[model samples]
Target: MPTSASQEALTPLRPYCGRFAPSPTGRLHRGSLAAALASRLDAHAAGGRWLIRIEDIDPPRDIPGAGEDILRTLERLGMPSDGPVLWQHDRLDAYAAVFEDLKAKGAVYGCACSRKEIRAAAQALGLPEGVYPGTCRGGTGGREARAWRFRVPDRDVTFVDRLAGPYTQNVEKAVGDFVLKRADGLWAYQLAVVVDDIFEGITDIVRGADLIDNTPRQCLLYEALGAPVPRYMHIPLVLNDRGEKLSKQQGATPLADDDLLGELERAFVHLGFERIGADSIEAFHREALRCWADRFAEEPA
Candidate 1:
């Protein structure tokens, strides 16, 4: 049998493909703008392709026309992505295909636990405390049709983040057998993202720090599918006075078209890029890109 290390080496290596996947829940706010600018700049600086994907898999929460508004904001900010945007809603069949493949490999099972049941079970078992307690791990939750969860083995999933450095999480304890498909018949973010990234040839993921904890679970799913994993960079999340992440739900002000230059300067400063002045948006973009390139070139690999 091939050694585990050698088996890992057999996995395919992909090029530098960075992407920004945003949910269509609302208009792009300051935090979202920072994330988009960072990801786009990183990809461009690395001589890689940057792409955008609409995360609209959850129909109930999606706001009408929010996706288009996000695209327009990015365009106004002068950071348009390459090629057509990929919408998650249009890739259901692809997610289903991977779900079936994992099921065939005996890596998944049907889950029949209600939210209340799982929460109670987690409290009783002294589990790490999450929504699901793996009460149906042996298929005995005593519930009806709901969803499916991938079986997480007793092992630690680890990865080195490009920005946040090295990290590890035990999938079985941290999040027991996470859902691949939801009870409402929609694919989970974990499943959909893994499938979509592989399909789109994505090699680098740049997003906010809120998703840092989710990296291990994604890594597990990628391994289960026998797919190559991408490098991850989790930027610092912008917070309000209440120490909560900035979001539309939190009443974060949207980026107005007229304030593009001001917003862009603030975003670059927030990201630690220097040499920006109170100038027109066009001049700011040019000067910022030049300064960014100079700083990046000075950094030793």
Candidate 2:
């Protein structure tokens, strides 16, 4: 059993908390806006705190000022964070602490294999591609530790998404021992995200559908650390002319500020809300909160 101090470190500050965490790679486009609006509305419906977190852990991919710009756009849309925004870059120590806990518990190991080595090994052994073959799980064998990986249980991990419904994945078979920290000396998204959500007491997670596959990995992390798993709802993605998910890498345009009402309307419609004749942000949110609650407020059966 953990001592009181260690237990306190893992406890959430609120009973219900939801967050919209956006990476600083680009400005908030329509796809991201819809997700942000949904998360805020869900929090409002649940009478919970909705926080905004800047996922700026990947400095190389982050635009220097994109994070601040995203927050400004959110404020313009009348969906500012409920509390001071948490930036992942500012919480390295916290991530390290959690990693140490996992390491001490024997739930993680050092991985010395490079991506090339893993791919080659998988091809050679006829293992499914992209699944680590446990090359370094035993020990580095005189090689340097390039990254830290979480050991996954062999059984299936199942969870019901509020919007997507029942979902399951065998993390060990599908993703193998996934990374907690990278060889580049930066924390992995899987580790940072789970740790942040746990520390913040996030009871619900609302994001894009593209991230559905990442849930099982995070679930494993939460279980390993004995933290409560948050409920998940992954909203649909906004597609572009090419029928591709609108993303920064896909050259998605930054949200135009001139027609905030029109933008919000489109986002609401994308989330399956009927168009409303709202003239202001306040009116839109008022109706949105009602619509969202009517649809998703009850716990999924």
Candidate 3:
């Protein structure tokens, strides 16, 4: 079980750990920078560890040098990870362990359904589009499995976000058996994330609200693995004029300069952080850490 993000004193944890994980599809946009700043602030405030992970699991979509470019941008922004950074590419073996564990528990099954077939099935079944309809709970013999999916129950997975408040998702109905490994043979985010969080002892996850829907599914994986779930806080997203979440796919522009402190200050203010007129970058960080610490600090038991 995980401690609630309810501001109560979290059970004595392994100190505290947080992370900034970006897919490296493009440079860091304002929205990405805000998430980075929020993660850094929460870690510093809690006197915890902050780390980085490059989520480059999909090789075909990866721009060869985009990962290094993201690292350079973060370095210029003055937010550095506490320990050596982790790369998803190098962690396949680790993920495989979790995959096998789920297989042993019969928590995952093979699926050979194509996107087209799934969509057709959704229409015929009258389920919402995009939610897979569990078309292949049994093995699709002869044809190799296109993907591996976790079998979700109809029961609800509930968790409170420190910032977003209560949220729930009944994975079975909302998103039927979701993929653990993609048809492209790449690892799925759901499986990799739960394994990594457990590996790193991550205590809290603070990210953009766009990922709020992903929390419940991840929680289900946590339960399947019998691991502790982390507290979550999904912050408001920085959207483009089109009302879409700012993302590389939306052609969102990346940080174009090396003005680390200036960009950091702007991102800090963008997250509704207040600053004293005379505070230097260092001063703002100091005070901001104190403020976040108080806001997230565990209530005295």
Best by TM-score: 2
Scored by CA lDDT, what does every candidate get? 0.80, 0.87, 0.81
Cα lDDT of model 1 by residue, 1-301, tens digit: 2112222222223456788889999999999988998888767776778899999999998999999999988888887878689999889999999999999998988888878878888889877568467677787546675889999887777776656666777778788889998999999999999899888888778789999888888888887888777777788888888999999889898887677888898888878877488567678767776666676565324
* lDDT-best of 1 and 2: 2
**Per-residue lDDT of candidate 2, residues 50-123 (tens digit):** 99999999999999999999999999999999998999989999999989988999998999999999999988
Predictions ranked by lDDT, top down?
2, 3, 1
TM-score of 1: 0.91
What candidate 1 gets wrong by more than 4 Å, as runs, is 1-14, 141-143, 294-301
Model 3 / residue 268 / CA error / Å: 1.5
Q: How far does residue 30 in candidate 3 sit from its true spot (Å)?
A: 0.8
- Kindly give the number of clashing pairs for every candidate: 0, 0, 0
Worst 10 residues of 1 by lDDT: 1-10
